[model samples]
Target: MGSAKWIACVSLVCLLGVLSRGAAAENDFGDFSLSRSEWSSEYMSLDSGHFLDRKLLQVQPSSQTQLLAVRGDRRDPLDNFRKYRGGYDVTNKHYWASVVYTGIYGFAIGVAWLLLGALITLGACFKLCCCRRPKVAERRSRAYYWIPRILAFLLSLFAIGVIITMFVRNSQLHDRAFKVRDSIAASANDATSTVRNVSNTLSNVDTTVSKYNIEGLNSSTLSSTVRNLNQQADSIDNTVDNNVNTINKLINGIEITLIVLLSIALFLVVMGLLSALMGWRTIYFLIILLGWLIAALTWILFGIFFAANNVTSDTCQAFSEYLATPSNTTLDELLPCVDLATAASASNVVRQGVNNIVAQAERSLTQIEQTSAALGRPVTLPTVCDPIGPAPAFEYNSNCPNGTVTLGGLPGVVAPFVCAAEPVTQACLGAGQFVSRTNDTQIRDLSSAGQSLVTIIPTVTRLTNCSIVYNTFEDIVNNQCPPTKRALRNIWIPLLLLSIALTLLSLDWIFANHRNKKERYASGRDPEAYNNVPK
Candidate 1:
């Protein structure tokens, strides 16, 4: 029963191997025909398979122009229209130009605000120092006395609220940035590990081929295939390492910039508030001037982040479209499909090598049995399955011919013959040893090679199909894109709002300070004026 079970298992592995080979024969790129069930089972962790339909494997447009044509003009006229409106093709050029324009727009607004604040500060200083005050200060209403103070207090409160919200948004942006970094690192690692596993497996297969030295099998094709795969894996590994290093540096720089800019903005706001409250006219004016410059810097940063967000969105959309139909697109140029011939040839070599080993073992067993019988210690040895047929291909049929035994059952069948045979003669002893060695070593090695080949087929299939990169892109589109875009918006939108609020607060502080100073001077000029002043 144990032998029968073992036979059934080996048979199943061979059957699956043959089926995979047949599937490979059907497609130039080797079994890329992923069924819905396969996709669900194999890629459920990616969370992007559901976004794809049966058409996920369909050939995509051959070039960027073809892809753009197929997708049609998807631009939002209102949102995307600018100086480069005619060049809006949603390509990198368009989005990058949009970024430049956005930065310029933000810079222009910031500079205008800075100029306005400068003029106000200069005018107020001139009125206080260069121009003479009226001999009698005009009587002001109670509403006028309290309104500016009330407005200043309200604006200060609003600015504080905005600052707190900006901090929260910035924290979220930091979290999202780290998550993006981790996701990319993880994906690259996964691809690297998968390729490494395949390279190792190919090496093992090569080792097995050389160790066994199966007759009638050519090692050249197998060696060349293994060498090519290893080289490819090494190239891929190096590329991933370089890209990851570059991206890590970029993300680290962005994070540092975020920290520095926010810290500066916060420091400026706090100092401006302190100077205004303490009635230090010179320090307050200096703070206001610095605030204008800082506000302008924040606007420029906001523009940069906004552009990044737009480009990210555009890239995500383009990638998602490619996922829906990946073949023949420009993405193919970036990530070429696996070579079908190399994959098929490797599998065929292993299969044929296994078959050759089995056939050679059977021929040795037959000679040993005949020699044992002629030497007066006649013993029947177990038989291996005939060389696997090309037509009516090898399936799960383990039942041997009338006089032979199944490949897996050979050991069991040979076991009793060797154990029961006596070493009555040197010739009989020699025959038994040959039979034992053939059964124990060569047949065992053949089975091991078959099992190894079984594993190699699927790994080769996956590599050739480009499913690793496919799944990575799917993960980017489904898992990474939305949160990244939201995080970018959170950062830039809060920055823009904070810049505007801080600018307004500066203006309010200047006006309130000027009014207080004028009131103090007027009160000093007349006791009646001091008496008339509201408490």
Candidate 2:
């Protein structure tokens, strides 16, 4: 005992003397930047399935042009518009509160148990020579020693409860989700009705939006006009309907994945409990301890990812906000008519054809007006539904060669329209044409030839409704984007606390095992007596 006491005094003096020397410089110089200003850039993307600027499809042309102007127009901002056409984005709802608390408790238990195990094990082994055991020691260990194990179990249960609670809370949101979905469907239906209303209204306007009703024309221009109008309306309808279907699919996929994940987790939990209950507690401890390390590493990695994507998170939030507005404000201004613009401007030939047709229609309207100049007098035209120069002529189709034919084979001039299907002779072409109509219909309208242009505004307006909902694959991206906020507060700090928990729990478990083994003799006899007597 005297020798042990002397050794302890000398060790304490040496430790104090070493610490007093202020410890060798732990860090080399230049480890940190001594700067007043710092600039950083992150390559985080808004869509996990893509990288960088490629996912921004519905870019505001105005904004892009603005950027171009800022850069002195050296770059074409339109070049940046790239569409994302991928499968459903996977989602993660970060359950921070529950995750952090559970981890904190585990870490603390590990630390406490490790300490307890080390101290008690050393004392029992008589390694601390001065601390001699009593000859008549208590036969059993104190109930207080089991507190850490009990607390660990209790805390584990609490974490499970928290997870269950989150599921419950989100289940309510699912109810809300159904309502929101129905509302969006209603909105789409209303927009469809509005387009039909515009069509019916335009039919009443004279020479402005209706057909000229020229007689016996092989290709019925009026029917074609109505067909085009209906086609535009249908595109709006189809785009929204497709978007809704995709969203539904996404939800179904998420539900399935979540179910699979939870089932696996439950299986792990059950196996762990079964092991412990069956007295293979050491194995159970190892399972839980190793499981905790893996889980901690996973969470810490995820937390780092969330922290790194600060800009992407903000952009996702901005996208959400952009979609929420119902007005024709900047949101409307920015995105409205863009689909039509993209479809229309996709080819220079198509634009030129559209221009020529518009010019011819104007000329026809003027000539007809001059011939019928008598006030309130109606004049029958010498010819109705005249060719109008076939501005939107097909450059390619059944009989026409792709890229070699344009504007119905204008030869020298650029053909404005191009057809991807059979020629207009055998097929009407495009969507309205695609909807199934005869190439040569005798049906004609009594309205002016130029009147068909009125469908543009209504078509554009209806199309904007598609953008108001889940228009693309980014819906899930926005939903799942990780926020940089609260990671340190909700994740890392709690993880640190969890490390503390783990340390404590390890000590308790280790010490308790020794206590059980040390007292496993007749009437708490010392080791020497137990070795010699009644055996």
Candidate 3:
């Protein structure tokens, strides 16, 4: 009995080991089953399912009697029973693991979102309290006069958008992670159960179990298949490591972008508040205008980041698929081609051939990588592709003076080369010109230091009268003209508050007028008093 206990314990230990490996494998694919639907997608969409199936799917069976064949493949009656039991156990474990991870990730994202919401709410309260003391009419004027309230509102909106985006992304990552975990656990359990039951049945009859086993192979085939599968898994592991390393670089870039954007936004908010409180209208408006201008400028940074992300993701996915089989042509062909010359001597032909293929692959990979980095990375502004009428005809370059804009060259022709972003220039040399070229309506009536903004676009007539054009350059390095300078105008909140204080001086003027008029009218009753009325 003691000997029997020892054997059973060893068997159980081995069984657990097999289950663990199986579980991990399933997790890699999330909970997504390799059903007919999945197989079809892998076949048509990926165009590389055969490679994955032969390399990774054909690993050695974990124990005697265990098999890894097509789901419905006909097998000996006893083998079928063992496979079914093993598959079920694996499925169960993976599902449980997935649930746990999903819950944890969800909680973290929820907490972050809640915190951001609370901060916004707190900011709003402060805003209301600050203005509560003034009369209703005065408060109304203060609100419209544009100061802390507008700045706060805009900042809050930006924060909200950011928070929402983060929540969505976090949720997606958590979901995918949990799915992989669950599938791995379940697959392990299933594989283990099948082996255990089969081993037990064979032992009951004192039948010796085979040392090596393959799902659909005889003894000789079993050993070779097992070796190949092991090699394939190892290769895939290496590839995964490479992909992760690249992703880390992208993650670092994203962190920097987020930090810069947040700092700029926070500083703007503080400055706007201070200006409004100080009663300096000119200064306040100037600051507010600056904030809007910065926000608009951020749109370009966002676009570049997005482009980078797309490239990286595609490259990573392709790499992941390649790793599942080292012998596969997809990865093998592309891994070695960095610097060999294609037009070299015959002695160098072998090196050149490999390098040529690798070089081609590297170029494709680089483009994808750059795109991915840009996408996964965060930016200060979200890209807004809305057609804000026609683009500006103004010529913009990095060399353009900071605050003074110039539209050089002839009127009816295309605007000079102006890129929204420096690195990626628009293709057509004279692609699109600014819509306000005709000067039918003066965009800016510039005379001396003062300038008034007028809209040339008839569709946006509302801005024609009130919008004041100030001396400011394009939103970005490129001449992607933003909504007329009103959006760019920095109505520094702090400055706006100062202006309100100055507007109060107008009240003093009204009071002085009243007193003078009263004295003059009273003096009219007596000529002597009328002469005494202060000038």
Q: TM-score for each prediction?
A: 0.66, 0.37, 0.24
Q: Which 10 consecutive residues of model 3 have the lowest summed lDDT?
A: 466-475
- Among the numbered candidates, top TM-score falls to 1
Candidate 2 has a TM-score of: 0.37
Among all windows of 10 consecutive residues in model 1, the one with the lowest summed lDDT is 7-16
By TM-score, the better pick of 1 and 3 is: 1
Error of 1 at 36 (Å): 32
Per-residue alpha-carbon lDDT of candidate 1 for residues 196-305, written as tens digits (9 for 90 to 100): 66556645755554544443233444556556656666665665565555555666676678677767767766665655556566776677677677777777777777
Question: By TM-score, highest first, what's the ranking?
Answer: 1, 2, 3
- Residue-wise lDDT of candidate 3 within 1-535, one digit each (tens)? 2211110001110110011011211111012111111111112111123323333322334342222111222122333223222211112333223222323322343344345445645775797788444211111232333434444445444544443444344334334323322332233233234323322322221111122111111223223323332443344344434433343344444445545554565565455545444444455444544444444334333333332222222223333333333222222122211111110111111111122222222332243345334545321211111111111211111242343222211111112322234333334213321123222111111110010001111111111110110000011101111211111122122222222222232222222222323123322254345444333
Best by lDDT: 1
Regions of model 1 farther than 4 Å from truth: 1-95, 99-104, 114-138, 141-146, 211-218, 332-440, 519-535
lDDT of every model, 2 decimals: 0.53, 0.33, 0.27
| Distance from true location, Cα of 411 in model 1, Å | 6.7
Worst lDDT run of 10 residues, candidate 2, spans 12-21
**Candidate 2 lDDT score at position 144:** 38
